[model samples]
Structure formats: structure tokens, C-alpha cells
Target: MPVPAKRRSSSKGRRGRANKGLAKKTLAKCSKCGKPTMPHHVCPFCGNYQGKEIIKSKVKKKAGSKK
Candidate 1:
């Protein structure tokens, strides 16, 4: 059986693992609401995609504020 000839250094091991960390999410500005959102996806704030309304975002009312 083959085995490691020398013990791997902690710094080298950490360096290798550095690339394994989570990457930052790529986001684009919403055309309608001007909010940050994922590219090619519907804007959660305005529900617009590619300058069109894809989702009809509804405004939620406070439970205590009733007519």
C-alpha cells in the first residue's frame, strides 16, 4: 500500500481548501424597480423580467391595520 511520504503542512492544506469555500452570488439590477436580483430571473421586488411583468407581486397588509 502507498502512503504519504511527508505530513502535509497546515498552510498548504488551508490554501487548497480556500477554493472550496462558497462563492459570491452573481446579481443584476432589476429594470423596473432598480433592485439587485439574479441575472435572467424575474425580479422579486417588481416581478419584472426583461422589461416585462412576469409575476404579479401582491402587497401584503398588516394584520392589525384592518378597516
Candidate 2:
């Protein structure tokens, strides 16, 4: 059994737990387009993540009537 000379500070043990909050990126910026995106998720502006297309936004082509 190990004994501490004085009161083992809670700060030492809190490093791992408290540091986790500060360890994460609050907002992930998109590389394709400069927009704020959530971590591990596709960018809403660029629709990409992890060098792959994740969110597929469709654009409807307009139909032309023959005269």
C-alpha cells in the first residue's frame, strides 16, 4: 500500500477528467468550404467529411418544354 505524505490534491487526479473537456475542439472547420462543422460529422456547407462525401444534397434540374 502506498501512502501520501500530505493530502493528495484533487487537482492531480482531476487532470484526466477535467482535461477531457478542454481536449476537444468546440467547432470543426470544413476544409472544402470555410464553415463550422460538428466533429465526426459532414460539413453542412461543403457536405464532406474525412475526405469522403457524407451528406449528399441534391440539386433538381429544370425541365425545358420544346417549343
Candidate 3:
């Protein structure tokens, strides 16, 4: 394996690391519920996709006192 001829400078290393940072995620609004979601994906809040219900939402039911 060919090794580097000279030690990399700190400025050069820093410059390369700068572009490694993550970019902000792009979000789209759900037409039915008006919630922010990833484009072409089902809405997590309401289980909807493209203005239609694809997966049934698992809503927690209120627990009642058992006698």
C-alpha cells in the first residue's frame, strides 16, 4: 500500500471535515393532517400517505377502572 509522502496540514484536514457535517433534512407537509413529513413517505402522526390512509394508526385507548 502506498503511504502519504508528507503529514497532512491541520488546515487541510479541517477543510475536509467541514463538508462532512450533515445538512438539514427536507420535510413536506401532509395534505390531510397538515403535518411535516418526508416526501413520498407515510405520515407518522396520522398514518396517512398522499391524502389516503395506508396503515391504520395505533392510537392508545383510555384505560378504565376495572372493578
lDDT of 2 by residue, 1-67 (tens): 9987787578877875776666655898887776788887888765688877776633211223333
My TM-score estimates for the predictions, one after another, are 0.60, 0.42, 0.60
- Report the number of the highest-TM-score candidate: 1
Candidate with the greatest lDDT versus the true structure: 1
RMSD of each: 5.9, 9.0, 7.3
Each model's lDDT: 0.83, 0.68, 0.80
Q: Which residue pairs does candidate 1 place in steric collision?
A: none
Candidate 3, residues 1-67: lDDT per residue as tens digits?
9988998999999999998887899999989888798999998777889778897765312122333
Worst 10 residues of 1 by lDDT: 57-66
Q: How many backbone clashes does candidate 3 have?
A: 0
Candidate 2 — which residues are off by over 4 angstroms? 1-25, 58-67
The order of the candidates by TM-score, greatest first, is 1, 3, 2
Residue 22 lDDT, candidate 1, scale 0-100 = 79
